[model samples]
Target: MIFDYLIYVFLGIGLFFNVLAGVGLLRFPDVYTRLHAGTKCTTFGSIFLIGSVILIGLKLWWEKDTNGSVLALHSALALVAILLTNPVGAHAIARAAHRSGVKPVRAIADHLAESPPLQTGEKTDKKQQPQEEGGK
Candidate 1:
């Protein structure tokens, strides 16, 4: 009885986090922030959700039922799917956002933007001037 109650508690907690993730997605402003919130929170929440399912599956399997074993195996596969895809999806979103120029709010520094200017004509020497070396 106590063990069953514990399983229910895990389930409830998992559901709560998933719900919180949804709320974060709806409430956050701008694309970057929204993506950040959506990706991280949802990933975290999903762990709990899947963990709860896994626990239930484990409990079932412990009871020596055939269906429980199948359920547990499938739940593990689902967890793997979630783990592999979440980070990759988040990376894709972040890359797309960056390429689209959706800058983060109040960003003071841009390291990539500060790269040295590119020379159009040719490669310049370290100690000599380009104008003296190549006459245009």
Candidate 2:
């Protein structure tokens, strides 16, 4: 009784935030803002979604026997997987976007302007060549 109501509540919250994330992705004006909303909102919503499943699994396990235990354990593993992957993937995407030169819109200042790109490459242009050539 109470468990079912809690599961429904979790699902509702998850769905609401997921929708908010979608709206933020579409409505945000800049890459950084969009990324912020997309990552945090989706992660929050996903936690709730997975939490609902976990509750459902626990309910089944409480009510039933061995098979329910498997379901509950697998859901727990899935929740762990989501927790491990989401932030790492979000960091990778943000770094990739920054490295690939996607600047934020209407940004007044950039603190990372002095920071060098993560992966260095060989200087391919003569402008970047060493100033060691003798005068003619």
Candidate 3:
């Protein structure tokens, strides 16, 4: 009785957040903001979605269904993967955007402006070139 209600609650929350994420991706001004919205909302939504499955699996396992254990285990594993990777992937995308000179729209503070790019090739700037040895 209450279990079904709980599942409904989880599903509702998950669907809400996932839909919110879609809106954020479309509505956010810059790559950083969009990535933040997309990653955080989707990650949180996936947790609720997978959590509902875990609950279902536990309910089935209580009824002596072997497949329920597998379902719960697989859902748990997927949850862990999503938790570990989503933020990291978002950060990577944001960094790539920043490195490629994408500026945030209407941003008041630019904290990363002082930080150097994480990876670079040989510098072509004349000032960056070293002086010749022995004035050669």
Which number leads on lDDT? 3
Evaluation by TM-score, superior candidate among 1 and 3: 3
Q: Per-residue CA lDDT of candidate 2, range 1-136, in tens?
A: 8878999999999999999999999999987788888988988998899889877777777887667678778877887887898889888898778757788887677666522542133234444323322321
lDDT of each: 0.72, 0.78, 0.85
TM-score of 2: 0.78
Candidate 1 lDDT, tens digit per residue, 1-136? 8877877777777777778767878987777777777777777777777777777778878888778778878877987888899989988888677746677778776554312443332244444434444653
Which parts of model 1 are misplaced by more than 4 Å? 112-136
Q: Worst 10-residue stretch by lDDT in candidate 1?
A: 113-122
Task: Name the regions of candidate 2 deviating beyond 4 angstroms.
Answer: 114-136
Q: After superposition, how far is residue 90 of candidate 2 from its true place, in Å?
A: 1.1
Ranked by TM-score, the better of candidates 2 and 3 is 3
Off by over 4 Å in 3: 114-136
Q: Which number leads on TM-score?
A: 3
lDDT order of candidates, top first: 3, 2, 1
Number of clashing pairs, model 2? 0
